[model samples]
Target: MKRFTKFVFKALVGFLALSLGLVLLFKFVPVPVTATMVMDGNGITKNWESLSNIDRNMVRAVIAAEDGKFCSHDGFDREAIEKAIERNAQGGRIRGGSTISQQTAKNVFLWQGGGYFRKGLEAYFTVLIEQIWGKRRIMEVYLNVAETGIGTYGAEAGAQRYFNKSAASLTPTEAARMAAALPQPKERSVVNPGGWLRRHGNTIAARIGSVSRDGLDSCIYE
Candidate 1:
């Protein structure tokens, strides 16, 4: 029993060291690929751009649509998680409460799916990224690596494919539409949005100004 315990302890230490080293390395390097990007099969269509090169409207829209408290949270949003749990208990459509930081960690380092093991690893990576990468770098990586559409990834590729424009040129409405499609990129079309998408996009657009005015997006700039 003592020998078995020693082996488990050593294995845990080795795993922690390797995961930390990889996360630290990625902080300085642009991630070239992710599990989801490869899973899509056609290969990633990413053109990694600096946060500045991606329009401010896009940033605001994403925050409004995804995580309103992104700038203030560490790696999780407790209230949103509670709400999601409560809603799911009612047996309606399932919902998610993952914050932007969690999503970024999963997108950049982990694969898709939900399980206790995967969620644990995602939480681990989320804490690592929030500590090592900071808010700006996290947002930059998220914008560049998120799967935006079928066979398309990143803000730049999504913009060009759906709007024939650059991410830097995306207007508020256009950005909101893009943000709206993020939850189900394969099903939602930003260029030719359905009525529900249009309404959701407009709702996000209305909140973008509040997100900025309330300084909920200041961390990225600061």
Candidate 2:
């Protein structure tokens, strides 16, 4: 029992240290990943500062596609999580109802998997990301790393590759399509808006009037 307790304590300490290290590393390192979305028709690493305010379209689209309750919560949304749990329970593999913070945790630290162990780690990392990176930074990283196309990543890259525009200038429909393509970015086409894209686009458009960019300022990162 004592040995088990010791092991647990050490693991907790190690987790804390590792989490801090990740926060520092992502903050300083322009995380070097191939742009999923091509920028200027050329695939390259797109790195931008965290302070950059993204297009209202992009923000609204992301919210519409991902977490609708991002503005109302701290790090997690229990209701969405419950729905996800019920869905995943009915199905075999795990499905996520993660908010942006939780998604950032999985994207940054954990492997893309649906295992219970991975889910727990994702939660741990989510807490850490929420604590360290705050809301705006989380949003910034999410936009930049979110896969925009098959092998196309980052908002700048996605905008230029899909619509021949910059991230700042993406229209509501364009942004909505990009956000909608997130679940299967590599398999799905951001450049071509198919059925899901059109449906999600319309959904985002309706929410665009209410999704609050101003409220993001209150996020822990901001």
Candidate 3:
């Protein structure tokens, strides 16, 4: 029992150290690819863009569509989590309450899944990123790595692939449409929007102004 406990303790310490080191390393190094991006096979069509070059409209639209309280929250959104839990209990279509930060951590450092072990590691990485990367870096990394469409990765690639334009030139409506497809990028076509996507994009477009007006996205600027 004593020997087993010692082994477990050493393993835990080693895991923590390795995880922390990786997180720290990524803070300075641009992530070239993610597990999902690799798994997709056709290869990622990402042209990395700096935050300033990626258009503020795209930023606002994404924040409004995905996480309204991104600038203020730590690693989790408690209210959103609570609401997701309640809605999931009622149960028709399952809902997810993962914040942008959590998604970023998972996308950059881990694979996609809902396993307990994955969730636990996601939580750990989320905390590490929130502490080490800061809001601006987190948002930047997310914009640069998020799987925007099938074989598409990052704002630049998504913009070019869907609109034949650069990410820096994305209009508010265009950005909103892109943001709308984020939840199910593979199935939702941003270029040729369906009824649901049109409505959802409109909703996100409407909310974008409020996110900026209320300074809900000010952290990136700070």
Candidate 4:
């Protein structure tokens, strides 16, 4: 029992230390190998570029698709988590209850994997980033690091490759499609832009109004 306690303590300390270090590092340095996937008969990786209007609308689109309760919670939303648990208990696809904050944490800090250990780390990192970074910054990093295509890494890269423009130039319709491609990024043909992609994109675009981007101004102060 004592040994187990010691191991847990050490792990917690290590996690805190690593999260603090990453936050400091990100503030000062652009990551060396940040990537985005693109299509030109074939897909390829390219550097990620941060954008100016990685704004409320874009953030809203992501929240609409991923986590709509971002602004209300501190780091985790217990109610939603419980609801997901209930759904899974009744036989669902085992969807996560992660918020945008959590997803950003995974994209920027943790590796891509589907396992208990990785998810635990993702949760730890998510909580840390939310407490340290503001909501806007969290969304910014998410937009810049999230995998958009088979190999695409950020919105800027996705924009240039998919729409032939900068991230800031993304229209509401385009942003909604990009946001919708997130959950099925690899299988959904984001880079290749196939028929299913167009169809799914349109579906997400139709629900854009429900996302409530401007309504989140309240959480801005939090």
Candidate 5:
């Protein structure tokens, strides 16, 4: 039992050191690939862009559509998590309240899908990134690594694939459409969204202005 405990302690220390080194390395270096991209059966396409090159509208649209409190939250949003839990308890599709930070951590360091173990690792990495990467780096990594469509990853790739344009030049409508598709990119249509998706895209487009006006995206700019 003593030997087993000692081995566990050594393993835990090794994990912390490895994870911290990776986080610090990625702080400056653009991530080359992710487990999600690797595990994808569909061929992956991505182009890493500096946050400066990716249009501000794209950032605002995602903040509006995904997490309104992105700039304010520290890696986690308790209220959103609580609401998701309450909704899940009532029974239906499982909803998540992951912030851009948490999503960035998962995209960069972990895999897709959920389990208690994965969620715990996600929480651990989320804290590491929030401390090490800051809001701007977290947002940059999220936009660059997130799977945007079937066989597509990143804003640059998504913009080029869907609109034949650069991510830097995405219009509000285009950015919002992409943002709307992000939650379930393969299932949602960014090019010709209909029904709730179209409505959601429009709503996100409108809210992008609010995100800018209210300075909800100030942290990324800062």
Candidate 6:
């Protein structure tokens, strides 16, 4: 028992140290790849762009479409999580309340899919990033590491693939279209969207103005 306890203690300490080192390293360094990117069977297409290089419209579009309270939340949104739980209890498609920070942590440090163990690790990494990466760095990494389209990762690749333009040149409508597709990059259509996808993109585009006017994207800019 004593020997087993000692082994567990050392293993726990080693894991913590390694996780911290990786988080700190990524705070300044561009992440080369992620578990999601590696697991993508379609092949990888990405071009790293600094946050400043990506259009502000893209940031506002994602904030409006995904997490309205992004600027105010730490790493998790308890109210959203509660709502998701309540909805899930009723039985239908499962919903998630992951904030941008949580998504970033999962995308960068963990693999896709959900189980209590994976979710726990996601929560752990989310806290680490919120503390070490800050809102701006979190947003930057999220934009870069997120799977934006089939076989494509990041805003740069997504924009070029969909609009034949650079991420820095995306307009509000274009950005919204990309943002709408982000939730289901493999299935959603960005180039010639219609039906629900088109409507959702329009709604996101309309909300982008409010995101800017209301300063919901203040954290990223500041």
TM-score order of candidates, top first:
6, 5, 1, 3, 2, 4
Clashes of 5: 0
Residue by residue across 1-222, what tens digits does model 6's lDDT show? 999999999999999999999999999999999999899999999999999999999999999988999999989999999999999999999999999999999999999999999999999999999999899999999999899899999999999999999999899999999999998999999999999899999999999999999999999886
TM-score-best of 1 and 6: 6
Report the alpha-carbon TM-score of model 3 versus the true structure.
0.95
Q: List TM-scores for all candidates, in order.
A: 0.96, 0.80, 0.95, 0.77, 0.98, 0.99
lDDT, model 1, position 44: 69
Q: Is candidate 2 or candidate 3 better by lDDT?
A: 3
What Cα-based lDDT does every candidate model obtain? 0.92, 0.72, 0.91, 0.70, 0.94, 0.95
In angstroms, what RMSD does candidate 6 have relative to the true structure?
A: 0.7
Alpha carbon deviation, residue 186, candidate 3 (Å):
0.5
Q: Show pairs that collide, candidate 5.
A: none
lDDT computed for candidate 1: 0.92
Give per-residue CA lDDT, model 5, range 104-156, as digits (tens). 88889998889999999999999999998899999999999999999899999
Per-residue accuracy of model 1 over 1-222 as CA lDDT, tens digit each:
999999999999999999899889988888898899889877668798888999988999999999999999998999999999999999989898999999999998899999999999999999999999999999999999998999888999999998899999998899999999999998898887878888999999898899889998999876
Better candidate number, 2 or 5, judged by lDDT: 5
Candidate 4 has its poorest 10 consecutive residues by lDDT at 33-42
Model 5 accuracy (lDDT, Cα): 0.94
TM-score-better candidate, 3 vs 6:
6
Candidate 6 whole-model C-alpha lDDT, 0 to 1: 0.95
Q: Is candidate 2 or candidate 5 better by TM-score?
A: 5
Q: How does residue 64 of candidate 4 score in lDDT?
A: 71
In candidate 2 the C-alpha lDDT for residue 135 amounts to 71
Pairs clashing within candidate 4:
36-152, 36-153, 37-152
